[model samples]
Target: LGMRPPTPAHPTPQYKGRARDFLYAGAEAGVMVLNAGADVMRFAPSLVVEEADIHEGMQRFAQAVGKVVA
Candidate 1:
């Protein structure tokens, strides 16, 4: 994946952050996020996925970010 912020792909190495930590936290929160390559987090929801599902997934993602991010 190309440069993506909050996924260890930032232009600044010091602010690149950590994708592993986010992935781990997401897993613990029962949220599944895939890596397109090494940095981009791919969140491909199913066609049957509803609005509420997206909302909930985002909430979980936010929580995971909070866990690993400052």
Candidate 2:
């Protein structure tokens, strides 16, 4: 199946001060160190997903984070 972009992309409003700098710095570090693809932090909604699928996605996300940090 062909890949499709997520609908209704969430917008992260701009921040200011040290927090803004930190966010950018963290993103830069993540990109440099992890070389993660675009979907690394994706949040996909279930079109008709059951509770089990939601749970599985959560578990998978947790596992991915663990692997990245480990």
Candidate 3:
């Protein structure tokens, strides 16, 4: 969460490059979808995904973005 602050996918006046990169990283990790536009991230976990799985998924999500932002 502290890795990088979230920003708008479609900034009103201008689009930001870093925000778009963050969205792409999240999607590549299979952790969540950047659906709700570039500014929002959505986690669509199935009911079958256990609590442990959720935790692991989040960890993976963080790792994926960490590489990009770090």
Candidate 4:
């Protein structure tokens, strides 16, 4: 999340391997993200997911991204 936003013209291309880093870190943090491709990290929390759960997921994801960058 600390990384710059993807460019509108080439979003996924900018974070190709970082997506995998996120997936692994998310898994380690007990978050499941479905991968659409080599560069896509997809999040589809359940329709009944609570707000707190969403916030927690984001925290996990941000931590993962930080580790990856660090």
Could you estimate the TM-score for every candidate?
Answer: 0.70, 0.39, 0.58, 0.72
Model 3 TM: 0.58
Candidate 3 Cα errors over 4 Å, as ranges: 1-20
Ranked candidates, highest lDDT first: 4, 1, 3, 2
Residue 18 of model 4 has an lDDT of 60
lDDT string for model 4 (1-70, tens) is 2333322211255566567777887798887876666677777777666869978987987787667666
Q: Which residue pairs does candidate 3 place in steric collision? A: none
Compared with the true structure, what per-residue lDDT tens digits does model 2 show for residues 41-66? 33444456565865665565445444
lDDT of 1 at 50: 79
Instruction: Name the runs in model 4 displaced over 4 angstroms.
Output: 1-14
State which candidate has the highest TM-score.
4
Scored by CA lDDT, what does every candidate get? 0.65, 0.38, 0.60, 0.67
Please state the error at residue 56 of candidate 1 in Å. 0.6
Tell me model 2's lDDT, rounded to 2 decimals.
0.38
Positional deviation of residue 35's Cα in model 1 after best superposition, in angstroms: 1.3
Candidate 1 at residue 2, lDDT? 33
| Among all candidates shown, the one with the greatest lDDT | 4
lDDT of 3: 0.60
